[model samples]
Target: MIIDTKKLQKEVLENKKNHGFNTTDIEFELLRLYGETNELFEAWRKQDKENIDEELADVGIFLLGISEMLGSGLGEDITNKMKVNRKRIYKNRDK
Candidate 1:
């Protein structure tokens, strides 16, 4: 099923509120996102499939929460970025 990222972002914000989590600290969220990314890398290095997917979800949750805090539509941003990426050429592709 196709996920509704905008709805997910709203749910993340609501969950943060319900849990008394940081809803206004972008820097803290960024740091936590970095930590989550590290965890994802470690999981990949260990070839732990379950943990890998979990860590990835953690990273995505942080990102969606951050996007909510910043009042950005993550879905739209990703779609636009993908369009830009599709039009770009990598000079190092032959290397």
Candidate 2:
């Protein structure tokens, strides 16, 4: 099944608006994203599949929020950036 990321992003925006959240600080969003990433990592370390899934969702939520806050099309940006990443050859990624 294909997930409609654009639709998901729109839904996130709507949800935020419903909750009376106004996008004010990009720095706060960045910090939230960082915290969510660490939560994902912690879930992985604990081998908690359920928590991992939830953390993954949180990561996506923050990412989409950040994109919307920055007034960029999240879906388009992801597609374009991934295209470039897919073509790039990388070595020593772990180094």
Candidate 3:
């Protein structure tokens, strides 16, 4: 099934509220995102598909939460960034 990221983000925010998480602490979330990224790396290195998927989800959760805190539409931001990146030219290795 195709996941609805906006719905997921909304649920994440609601859960954070239910758990009494300090939603304003973007710094702490950034650190947590970093840890999740490292976990993803380790999972990839170990070839653990389950943990890899879990960590990847965690990374996305933290990122969406951060975007929520910043009042940004994560979906829109991603689309806009991708649009800009699509026009970029990479350096040739043989140059």
Best by lDDT: 1
Model 1 stretches astray by more than 4 angstroms: none
Q: TM-score of every model?
A: 0.95, 0.83, 0.87
Report the backbone clash tally of model 3: 0
**What is the lDDT for 52 in model 3?**
93
Q: Write the per-residue lDDT of candidate 3 for residues 31-86, one digit (tens) a residue.
A: 98899999999999999999999999999999888887877788888889999989
**Top-TM-score candidate index:** 1
- Candidate 3 Cα errors over 4 Å, as ranges: 1-3, 92-95
Q: Which ten residues in a row have the lowest lDDT in candidate 1?
A: 86-95
Pairs in steric clash, model 3 = none
Ranking by lDDT: 1, 3, 2
What C-alpha lDDT do the candidate models reach, one value each?
A: 0.97, 0.87, 0.87
Q: Give the CA lDDT, 0 to 100, for residue 7 in model 1.
A: 97
Q: How many steric overlaps does candidate 1 have? A: 0
**Which lDDT tens digits does candidate 2 get at residues 1-95?**
87777777778878888998766688987998899999999999999999999999999998888787777888899789999999999987977
TM-score of 3: 0.87
